[model samples]
Each structure stands twice: as C-alpha cells, then as structure tokens.
Target chain A: MRIRCPLCGDRDSREFTCMGHETYMHRPAGEGWGPAWDSYLHLRDNPAGVTRDLWYHGAGCTAWLLVERDTTTHDILRVELASDAKRGNA
Target chain B: MVKLVEKTPAEGLLPLEINGISLTELVPAAITSLMPFDGQEAAASALLSSLLGMECPHPNRSTGRDGARAVWVGRGQIFVVGKAVDASVARHAALTDQSDAWAVFSLQGHGVEDVLARLTPLDLNRAVFKRGHAARSLLGHMSAVILRTGENTFEIMVFRSMARTAVHELETAMRAVAARDALR
Candidate 1:
C-alpha cells in the first residue's frame, strides 16, 4: 500500500515505518509519575477496524504523520502531518 | 599541527563514465540548510529571495538559475546549493552549514531516467517530472534527494557516509541501462 504524505506526495509504504499508535501526542507531562504515566508508556490497545497511528516518513520527507487506516482492510483513510494534527489543522 | 587538506566525499571514486552515462561528484562552495521557525515562513522566504537571488522553493520544487538554487529537502526545510548563504538569512530562519554532511553527484546521459528508475520508486518520466522537480526518496536502500537539474542531467544527494554505496548503486544501474540499450 502507498501512503500519501502531506508534504511529499504519495510514496511507497516501504518508505515509512509504523510506530504503533498515535498516542505519542499524548505524553503525560508536568504532573510526572502516576498510573497515567504507566498507561502512557506501557499499555496499548490493539484495535481492529479504523484506527489512528503514527508513521514516520523516514525515506521521503522525514516527517511524522498521523495515519488513519483500517486495520482490517488496510485502506488508508487519511494521512496528516503529526505537527499539523497537534495544531488542530489536520 | 599538520596541514589539513579538504577532500570530497567521493574522492578518487567518481568521474566515472560508462557507455554514454556519466556520474561525477559535485563540489559546491556550500550547502546550507534553511529552516524557518514557526510562522516565519513568509519572513524567511522574503529574506532568502534577496540573499540567494531566488525565490524560496515550494515543496518538491526548486528555484533559481544555475550555480545557485534552493531545493526543498523536507517540510519547512530547504537546502541552499552552490552558493555560500548570506548571514542575514539566519534572522528569519535557522541556517546550518551542511557542506560536508552530504555527497552530491551529477548523473547525466541518454536513458538517465531508465538508470534511476531501477533504483528509485519516483516516476522519472520527462513529461511530468521536468526540470526543477525534486524528490526525497530511496536509492536502493539508502535515503536520497533526487533533483532534476536539466533535461538529461540529475543531481543526487545522499549522506556523506554513504558516498561509496550510492556511487556503486548508480554505477551498476548505469551499466545495466547501457547494456539494455546495446541490445536494441
């Protein structure tokens, strides 16, 4: 499957590495240690169907992307720059 | 202290010509990375225009005449090629000298796209990928920046450490393409 990078156009999937989920944007900050940190660091849910995940465009633009894809069908629903998604622009 | 002499990344390994294809190292005066701070895109672009004498390139597009150009490397980042960037460019953007960080080469000849097509996934057809178009993609297993500098000429940039690997890959592809042509 090809992933369309927001900045680099549609590129082969081999150029990207999937980094599990998009929860990387929700790091437990300032408050420090607690169960929240534990959950953020260790716990994860392997959900099927449409899911949001983080992908690094390592070979192409080197941009972090938030990819919304169907885990079952492997159809990419959307691809946005993680920075833009964090800024509510995606 | 001993005198230090500068050597190019592909020193003694390039200027190779096989059949009609040639691969040669390009030693530019400087290659600086230009990255605009958040919300400073317009400001940085305006400054870069006067300093580099060219418009700041858009994503996947390069701008400027020969000997001086800006090739977009990634989102919010551009590589200023063939010219020593002006100091004022830093006021609106972050400037980092990448002169020695990359191995730059010029690959030229007939069926040059055919040579690259075997290495990269990029569509190298001349009809769509014209002069000034650029792409950040893989050349074999190595990440590379490929730029179209002319109709039959292309500029390939990879990390300095991968100079030998890059040359080897391109040379193999060049010879294979040349051999294929010989069969026709």
Candidate 2:
C-alpha cells in the first residue's frame, strides 16, 4: 500500500504508523458527565473492513493522516493530511 | 547524560575485521539532542533532507516522553534520532552524541533481505521495506534496529553484546542463502 502526502508525494505504507480513528470528543463545559467520559474511553467501533484511521508519517514530516484502509488486507485506499481534511477538502 | 563507548571489532565479533562500525549499545541518549526544536518532526525531516540531499518521505515526530522520536532506523527500539543546537542545550533536553548511540554494519549483496528475513519477522518486500521506513523489532532473540542504507545494503544496529550474535546470525543466514542458491 502507498500513502500520498500533499507535500512529499507518495511513499510506501511502512513509512506510516497507524494511530487509529480520527473521531474525537469535546469536553463538556460544566457539571456532571460520567457517561461522556466512559463513552470517550471505551465505546469505540472496531470495524473489520474499509475504515478511516489516523496515521502518522514518522519517517517524513510528522504530518497527521486520515486514511481509508482495508483492515483485513492492511491495504490503504485513500489518505489526506489532517490539516487538509480539516479545511474541508473532502 | 550517559557515557559513550566506541565499540571495537575484537570485543564484539570473532576474527573481527575493520569492516563495520558498531556502537556498544542502542543508548537512546545519543539521538536525544535532535528533539528540542519547536516542531521536532520538521527538524528531523530537515536534518535528513539536508544530510542525504534527498527529500525524506516519512512522517516524523518527537516521542515526547524524553524528547525521543520514532525514526525508521529499521527494526527495534524505534530508533530515536536527534541532534542538539547551542540554544537548546541549556534545557536539559538536548541530546549530545553521549545521549544517543548506534552501531552501523554495512551488509550488501544480492540476497541481503533473504538473509535478514531469517533474523527478523519484517516483510522485506521492496514494496514493503522500501527506503526511509524503519521498524523496531527483534533480530535473533536480541533487540535491534535495521536501516536500509542503500538498495542492496543495510546498516544493522544492536546492543554491544548482541553484536556478536547479530553478526553470527547474519553471516550464517547469508551463507545459507548462498548455499541454497548454489544448489538451485
């Protein structure tokens, strides 16, 4: 599998380290929130097929990547930098 | 700060020749100095880019705990490569050569991977190993970091004592491959 970086071009999948899903939770502003914490820590989907994941290019630029990958085959399908994805490049 | 030991051939390998450079240990401290820049990943990228004169195409970041970064120096300990500039030295976060350590062995030939696969579990497919991708894994029951220095060459780093074991395993594997190829 290969990952294409906006600045560095495409590189082998081994150069990237999988950091899991990109979904994150915002902290509650005030008051009791027991369930929120529990859900944040434990309730995460463990899908088997094409999944979106957070990967880091620890050998290149330290860019955070959101990649679509086939978990069963470890084949990466699409990759976008976190900075670009946040800018709505979807 | 850790003391640096320059390993000699006789102390580690049998009938050692002046062929490879080995460090006494993986001594994490040697590369720690390169971690203090504002964006450590950028700094690492720049260092390799400037040194190698090629764009380093891997994502890099400081490991954060001890100003370490997970560099692809091949297999094991997630090689933390760092450098220190004058300004950052005062922070007690800089890594001098004393802080980080490495042992470089130059292994070249047609079947280098065939020999390496015997000691490491990594999938060394050109499509997989490529260049600039390093992994932390075991080599012959010892911790090691393997770096692909060239298309047909690799620089394997391990603790000082494991150096002998590593060389033995590598030579044995290489000879085995040669023998097998001869039969074929």
- Return the top candidate by lDDT: 1
Q: Give per-model CA RMSD.
A: 1.7, 8.4
lDDT of 2 by residue, B64-111 (tens): 222233354321112344333333332422343423244445566666
lDDT score of model 1? 0.90
The digit string of per-residue lDDT tens for model 2 on A1-59 reads 77775544565565668866766413334566788766655677888888887888665
TM-score of 1: 0.94
Docking quality band of candidate 1, CAPRI definitions: high
How many residue pairs clash in all the candidates, one count each? 0, 28
List TM-scores for all candidates, in order: 0.94, 0.50
For A1-90, candidate 1 gives per-residue lDDT tens digits of: 999999988889989999878877888777769998888888888888999999999998899999999989999999999988888932
What C-alpha lDDT values do all the predictions have? Answer: 0.90, 0.54
